[model samples]
Target chain A: MSVLAFIDQSEGQVKKGAYEALSYAVKLASQLGTTAEAVVLGKLTDDIAALGKYGVKKIYHVADEQLNHLDAQVFADVIAQVARAAGAKIIVLSNNSDGKAIAPGLSVKLKAGLVSGAVALPDTGNGFTVKKSVFSGKAFAHVAIKTDIKIIALNPNSFSITEAGGGNAEVSAFAAAVNTPKVKVTAVNKVKGDVPLGEAEVVVSGGRGLKGPENWGMIEELAKLLGAATACSRPVADTHWRPHHEHVGQTGLAIAPNLYIAIGISGAIQHLAGVNRSKTIVVINKDPEAPFFKAADYGIVGDAFEVVPGIIEEVKKLKGVA
Target chain B: MKILVCISKSPDTTAKIAFTDNNTKFATDGVQWIINPYDEWYALVKAIEIKEKDPSAVIHLVTVGGADVEPVIRKALALGGDEAIRINADTPDSYYVACQIAETAKQGSYDLVLAGKETIDHNSASIGGMLAELLELPYVSLATKLELNGNTVLITREIEGGEESCEVNTPVVVSCQKGMAEARIPNMRGIMAARTKPLKVVEPVAADSFTGIVSFELPPAKAGVKLIPADNPAELVRVLHEEAKVI
Candidate 1:
């Protein structure tokens, strides 16, 4: 039995989380005393052999042009076929958008036990149990998979990426029957942002305390200075001060960044659920009693108008940017 | 067109989360259950919008749980569903829940299946894809916007950085999230009418769950915040750089 990691890519470029999944699969493979391999669909622009840095010994490339865009059904079918052919006892992938789309379908196709948003490695010592965040990171659950074939989709940033000693993975072209896609892609609109929120190391978010969209200049300036992505609270989005896509909360996007700066936002439990996983939280609010301060690692009890601009100047001074 | 809308009960957004039974089950004493917002506000509301356009469209709400879920189901009916069905099982296993939902959808032969992207409690976000696979139908996930055009449906779903527009024929599954539809509260007339709505209780079909929860854990509590006075905003940046090292 082998462990197979499905690499997710966009526009021929590998996603940041794919490497983490590959590394995870490699570690799991060693735990199971099996070999680790990778499978990549769609044509690629990057060197597939270089993925060996993640410790996978071999990779199966199905360079199909039709597989470029995500068709969850087709992707699941191809991965299932490859997993069956390779005698894969375990399959690993990212729990990002693409992985979420594919893993569930693949589990059904293979009748394998599946765990999504797994935050840690499986406890193989105790019947292959996996720990995952539940209730929007408010809690964690240890789930045991009972099936022989298991699939795990790791939450992005949950596992660190460890590079192997050094070697190129043997890249072999594998052919599988690609089914016609039931979902037809009409258009792809890439939201051009300075930094994608999901991949952003630092995030500066605003709330209703900004007062209006007009006051958002300082928020943007602070985010720009910090090289961070900008986000907003649900009320800001609901009031049309920001786009719904920028909203981060229980009902919105859940992000896990290294540094999260909240300005003018009262930390509600719902909002905290979305972002509690962030490594370091900084809250700037006029109200010292704001619940957000409790969760913040560092808090400034001040007005965003006064505090944000002051912080911006300080950051500029620290970074030596005029 | 027949639309099967899957709804689930979740703790109110502000409800305090705790576990009981050796951390194996969620604590429910004094907790209030409501329809999951994504399911109620987005999935069910959007289905109601479709039915508004075409009165022939039938929206049936389905939930998997014991009698406790019926109240939440009734609220969904009040919003606009024609009826509700309760699968008599209370399991945390998402695969089992998906199996139960698939069985109902198959028997109904619905042309469309809609569900929230994920329930707020477990947040597995897998039912739509799993159900679509089991039914051998197309699946579109995390859809922010959707419109029905004859037999084909136009959808806009959130990707990693941006969004993608796609088209799929009916007999498809979609998991709805924010921006799909506006949330609505049940008015007096709607609430009264909901009382008469058909609520069928069905026994679960034989299905094996491949996963089980062994235990639950709460994340470590955050250390108390380190406060910085308003006058020393620059000090905050200094600490972030030299101490926190985030800047």
Candidate 2:
């Protein structure tokens, strides 16, 4: 009878993507003629009641320290119980790492129709259908969930956030049976970067054209000035020019940043598969026939050493940085 | 050691996407299908590597599809799987597919189950988790690196901004991505041997699907590239700031 949004938090802080999911649920609840509620695991540093501005009427907090690290089965079990208790006909989540792992297990547990990587709002005029990106953002699929309960994992940066005025949610503690983890986390290795690629608005990606790893100073400078994430093509990752996490291609992380700048990387179809969703693409390759130029919103055919520094200077001037 | 690898075929990465029958079905007129990259390049490769290291290890391939999927299964065998199993059914629902695989694995008693993180076609990325639930086994999604030991495995999976290393006992399910293993092409000898390998066809278990596709549509095509002359780097930045408002 209600909509529930799983507002994922990390290190006791609500992520930016969760705000989009919460806001998305708020709109979905209004359309369904019901109120929206939110669920979070572990204690949070952010004030839970302040989330009411996103249209959540109640906040269900499961304060479990063990829940800090994401365990897919444990989360799925706990969320399924919350959904059943709240009568959540529609469950909303960000199509993120946690969401991707937990939503599928949850779908089986709740027998709910799940649509992940949803790009837009559902079209409910005739029947409930959610539009999602398929073929790695090459196409769209309109899926109709026939089950009584539904789950949606919305893609991050696809929807804008909306806030409601003078709204406050009541926070209450909820208890659910926790399961013993089947997998044990032995070590955590953090990838150090200026910005987390998943949440970055702008991304500057390089390919093998940078020649070698030592010549990456310009790309880093540009990325630092723009506050953008740094990515690389698959070959670069394979050749050890960059870490595997920074590789952005069909076989790598699929990102939809607002602006994606590709340098020296031929826009191979495989490479484009992961980044084609970027709002704007700028290609910097000396090869006029490089495949990436065809998909770029803007193209510059020149030497990376020459063109990148000039662009960096302009960006620095624009930022008024000494 | 026993390993079960799930393989699926999908359109080539560069294939143009189109839908027919009012978007109810995918267009397959001229599309060239290949084993999903994750399956071929990571899950299957890692399985074969383990088999090569331990000659006693057995690797099996499974797929749930019609006769058209046999060629793909044969290809998996060509890559050195001991045998292959085809569940005679076709459904896009990941849970239904997982149920069939779970029932098969329950009987086979596989020590490890590996599948692509997701197929390039539907991109569901759900079967591994669902299968784990059905079989009551531990599950790991998007495992980039896996190292097998006596009865336990060390796993590395990508998190939001880092890598997470996990340890799980045998009878675990893992959906693999890149960094697990390099894809190996089938040699002439392997291809010849694959033609005679055992391919067992089994009837699928009854599993109901929860979702259905209403239709399919392609995204609006790009307007093509707007070329900015190489000499005018400043102008490109100006446009990015003024027109695109991206800066």
Candidate 3:
């Protein structure tokens, strides 16, 4: 029996979240006294063998070019078949977009218990129980999986990825037949940014207090200087001050970064629900009584225009960029 | 054309969250319930917009809850859904809910199935995908945009840093997010029409839940903030760089 990691990729490149899932599964496999194996669908640009650093003992590569584009049904079908063939007792996937689209289907198809948004490693001492974020990060829930097979969709950035120095793993060709996709790809529109929000270690976000979208240069400057991603509150996205993808709130993307800095955001409960998982939170707002200040690890009560300039100058100095 | 939109109720965003019974039950006192924003603003409105464009289309709203959830259903009907189905069961488990919906959709022969990406209360974004799996159909999750032309449906969804469009045939399931459509408010005519619109309450189908909640926990409170004076904003940055080492 093995713990199977479903490593997600886009355009043949592995996503950062997949590394976290791989590392997480490896640890779980150790605890369960089983080996960790991984299955990758579609093409891979990187050497699959190198992922052994994460402690995966074996890698299964489907190498199907047609599997590059995602169709949840087709993807789930192949992954389920791989799980059955591999005798996997637990399947691990990152709770990112790809995992979100496919994990639930796989659970239903395999009759496995699924725990999405898993934050911590499971506690197997008593019975298998996984801790997960519920109510949009407002609370955590421990769910006990009673099924023989368990499926966990680890939240992106929730688990730290560990590397095993100079390890090697065996890679075998998986000859699983690819199903003809019912979903047809039309066009792809990618957000033009260097750091994807889901994988960013630090995030600098802005809100309506910035006045207008035109004044977003300061927010971008801080994010760029820190090599962090940029995000905004829901109202900013709703008003088209920023792209919808950058919106971080209960209804938007839930992010868990090492550091999350909010500028001009009032820290509405809905907005905080998406970002409260950050290891540290900083709030800069003119209102001292802003609700966000309560949740912030560090807070500066001042105008964003006045405070952000100082932060930008300091970050640039620290980075020696200018 | 038939479109079934799944509507869900959740505590108002500003409601204070607390637990009862040794952190096993969500406290309801002083909480205000509303239609989950994702369901009302995206999935339901998108379905309404589609129905308005094509007069031949019928929009049906479904929810799994008791009679207390009727107002939300009527409100959905008021927003132009032709009918509503209330599955009289309230087990917050996603798999059981998905099974109930799958049975209902199969009986109705729905051409398209739609739901919010997730419910705010549970944040379990599983129902749509599970429904598709149970019904043996294709599912597109977190679709920001959906367009139906005849039997073919076009969907635009977020994937990592990019957005991709896909085309699928009829009998497709889609979980909607923002950018699908704007939120709608019921007009006087629509409100009156909703009073008489059909709301069929059916008993839930039996489905075993494989997961049980052990307990609920609130995240630890933040260590009170270290307030940096407005004149010295650099202090905050320095602390982040040195103390937190996050920069």
User: What are the chain A TM-scores of the candidates, in order?
Assistant: 0.96, 0.96, 0.98
Quote the B-chain TM-score, candidate 1.
0.97
Q: Each model's TM-score, in the order given? A: 0.98, 0.97, 0.98
Candidate 1 interface RMSD to the true structure:
1.1
lDDT of candidate 1 over A1-322, digit per residue (tens): 9999999998888987798899899899988898999999999999999999889998998888879988899999999989999999999999888898999999999999999989998999969999998988899999999999999999887887899865899999889999888899888887675777776789999999889999999999999999998999999999999989899999998888889999999999999988998989999999989999999999998888988888888899988999
Evaluate all candidate structures by whole-model CA lDDT and list the values in order: 0.91, 0.88, 0.91
The C-alpha stretches of model 1 lying farther than 4 A from their native spots are none
Q: Which parts of model 2 are misplaced by more than 4 Å?
A: none
True-structure lDDT of candidate 1: 0.91
Worst 10 residues of 2 chain A by lDDT: A187-196
Question: CA shift at A15, candidate 2, in angstroms?
Answer: 2.8
Q: Write the per-residue lDDT of candidate 2 for residues A140-185, one digit (tens) a residue.
A: 8999888899999998888888987637799878888888777888
Q: Count clashing pairs, candidate 2.
A: 1
- State how far residue A150 of model 1 sits from its true place (Å): 1.1
Give lDDT: candidate 2, residue B12: 87
